[model samples]
Target: MILSVALSASLALTGSPAHAATKPVTFQGFTIQVPIQWHAKKEGVNLRVITGVCSPQAAECQSFLLGGPQAVKYASEGGPYRPDQPYHPSSGVTECVPVKKYNSGQATRVRTSKAVFGAGQRARFTEWKVSCDGSELNVASYTQRVWYVKAKKVIVVDHWKTPGLGGILAKAVWS
Candidate 1:
């Protein structure tokens, strides 16, 4: 009884299998694990899916974008869209440039940095701070981790930045 109790305590402290709350999901040609509260939706004609913290229709939301085929080709910089090519990390860094609007009483500020994605993969982290003439303001930040998994012919984008999004992406399984 003492041994069992000790083992249970250790598992709880280490976040063992019993403590993991995520569920496995298969999309496009890869599989990943996500929290039960999160939901996935198919977006665009291409093999793209957006998993959000809330329902897709929710007003305030953030999501992870998973794209297939052509998306991988377009992920690289300095090249035309070529569905047959893979993404090259050395090509260039992705930027987060939001166009400033004309007198909309709203201004947006974007900040970009380098962050680690799943398994130490380099990713672009962007924060968009939007404020209006009024007292209301919003800051949205997400990490776009794009990689061309040649075997799968897809470029998975783990667009994290919201609460719990990074944890979900950290445990993601591409296969």
Candidate 2:
């Protein structure tokens, strides 16, 4: 009886194993474990992961994208998307901020570092701060986090600031 009580306490303290609560999501030969509640869909050459509430009309919604080489090649309507450059999907203005009537302008790189993915793969991690301007002045700002694996031609872009995402990527298992 004492042993059973102690075992229950230990399990309660440590919680369940991470994998028990998560589901593996694979994209472009890379795999990461995300919460089971998250939904994923294929959009062209990219895998779109919806993490939160999103609107159909919103230009940028509450989600992230895992892109392959083909997706990168045509990320921008005007030209190819470069990891070093700011994320501009089109030449025209895009409403990135959740608030209506606000338009996004040039995004500036705020941070850059090396991020590890499945196995021992290293990626260029960049955080961009994009300003959202109203008709008169800047209304708000948001960060765009990107992990680019040049060797595998895979990129992960996140604008919703999903919790524990970096750690999840770090613990990924590549296939």
Candidate 3:
């Protein structure tokens, strides 16, 4: 229920760096084929995937999140909260916790990288999650920010605070 703003690098689909093989994780009627090495932790309806990144800023940690409510939020873009924006607790969201919001104009970024995917269930609540590197979370990037939706929402988790990683999270989809 913690709504925080986040982003990574922009996806250069034309010729981006491909990682390991794809192993798709199916949950809640959707399949997520993330890099084969990522490990998954199933907690009730949410299947959390832990991905590895080789970087000096942070290593042996940081991952890409797949499946669960958040993924549905981005794929459909019809949820209740937008990326990085100040959170307004919605009735559909029963678990959201209040968190400090950054005032650096998240609305503009939401408009730019906004995307909607998946057909999740009739959302009973909107859940906000921020990607964490180790124990810290809410690292900011230029092209990422808050976005708003009409109904309940979900999210995909990502590490790093640059716009580059954000691109991969947005484009990645499960078959």
Candidate of highest lDDT? 2
Local accuracy of candidate 3 as per-residue lDDT tens digits, 1-175? 1232222233333223465356766654445456656677774454556665444443223444433455443342344344344232222322111121322222232233334443332222122332322234454322223322224334443432323334334443433
Evaluated at residue 147, the lDDT of candidate 3 is 24
Better of 1 and 2 by TM-score: 2
Per-residue lDDT for 52-132 in model 1, tens only? 544432322355566666565555454433332322222643322121221112323354455444553444444433332
TM-score of 3: 0.38
lDDT of 2 by residue, 105-144 (tens): 6678898999988688998899998877635564677788
Of 1 and 3, the candidate ranking higher by TM-score: 1
Each candidate: what lDDT?
A: 0.46, 0.78, 0.38
Clashes of 1: 1
Off by over 4 Å in 3: 1-19, 53-61, 66-112, 116-153, 161-175
Alpha-carbon lDDT of model 3: 0.38
For candidate 2, the TM-score is 0.81
lDDT of 1 at 39: 66
TM-score of each: 0.43, 0.81, 0.38
List of clashing residue pairs for candidate 1:
143-160
C-alpha positional error of residue 128 in candidate 3 after TM-score superposition, expressed in Å = 13
